[model samples]
Target: MNTFTETTNTASTWGLYEQMRPQEIEAIQEKTPIAYLPWGAIEYHGNHNPTGLDSIKAFNLCKDLAEKNGGLVFPVVNLAANLIKSYPGVNFPKHSIEFSENLIRLVCEEYLEQLVAQGFKIVVLLSGHAGEPHLTILKTVAEEFNNKYPDKRFWALAEFDILPNDLLVANHSAIGETSLQLFYAPETVDLETLPKDRLITLELDAVSGDDPRLATIALGEQIVTSFVKNGSIIIEELKQKYL
Candidate 1:
């Protein structure tokens, strides 16, 4: 029933760090000293969506933005500070590396330092995970980093904040996220996997928002378009001010 035109080749000229050549990297830095880092967490989204939903959505959005606006899309950091344990079906896998709030802060600080060192004057930190604590930690780190290095500008915020109030209805694995996944990475979602009968479980009732069954690819496209438009506006404003 979804009558949306999907681009066969979604790739773009966004110089993703790992895939970019030296000349391409130099070109972006020379043209616009702006960089973006999409942050997300590896956690449960529901039975329908993939566990890496947060990172996947964030990275894809950043890639699209960078391709249009001219910047470098750093590799997505899929590790988040903490997992919301209250939700059912959530898994906190043990990491060989330390995954703590302090570590997150340190990692962000060092990454920004390196970006500045590489001649990037402005850095955007966009997170797909909406955990209040996680967002707060990132905000605190960005503020501290800016204070220490006033020459470089850093802004950290959740991706949903870029959307208009009407299109900003977001939840953990509900319609918003589910629709995003359906649009951005359709292979990662299988609506048929969700339980048919509505049970009053934490995963279904408490964590998830309105019925994900109502999610549509059209809605996903609208959300993505809104994010790109608003994000581009913010990026242009920063460029005008910083560059």
Candidate 2:
């Protein structure tokens, strides 16, 4: 028997696309026609962290942002690219599922088209999967589509794109990312698997930042709070400028 475990408790369906009703969606659209689309992939993040970390983190952030900023979380095709194999930085042939750039572009465009059709005035595409080429494709697609639709606007960025470098440095599966999961999805992280004495380097296990032992739920909450604070501000700015 497969028993389901509930992760979050505060109005579980507050901004989720899957759990919302048509009328509720329309009501939100009547007020703020903003949509948050979280994207990520099934990539290996050492044995300690779940491969779904990127996707889960992005989804969790979207949920929080929607609650604070007011938006309907939209679902995207589960496809990701720019794995360790192609990326210039840390490369780990870990358990990862990759898709072609062409497919990623096509899928992204399809979702944007649907969101535009739904009459969302502002569309925010945040990718937890942060890589230069992959992120560029999303941003390019959004920008070109913006030109196509004068009335509607599309903004695309990685989770780390809008964050300050000092507060939350971007690493593959290092301290920052791991800490995020710890805060958002504690069950998925097992720091004990990683050694506490030695440094956890990219060469060792594709962990590109500080040691995992240093990560704490408090630290994760701090980073998450920063993301939410900054994210909410930027989203409010978008609403004021455009809406």
Q: What TM-score would candidate 1 get against the native?
A: 0.86
Task: Give the clashing residue pairs of candidate 1, or none.
Answer: none
lDDT of 1 by residue, 153-223 (tens): 89898877877766756577778888888888887888887777875244443345667777888788898
Candidate 2, superposed: residue stretches over 4 Å from native:
1-14, 85-91
The local lDDT score (0 to 100) that residue 183 gets in candidate 2 is: 83
- Which tens-of-lDDT digit does each residue in 1-243 have in candidate 2? 111122333432246777788998888778878899998888888878998888888887777777777778876446888876555665576588889988899999998999988889888898888865787899999999989987777989777776788767778788888888888788889888987777777766778677777787777777777777787778878888777
TM-scores, each model vs. reference: 0.86, 0.88
lDDT of 1: 0.75
Relative to the unseen true structure, what is the C-alpha lDDT of residue 162 in candidate 2, on a scale of 0 to 100?
A: 67
Give each model's whole-structure lDDT. 0.75, 0.78
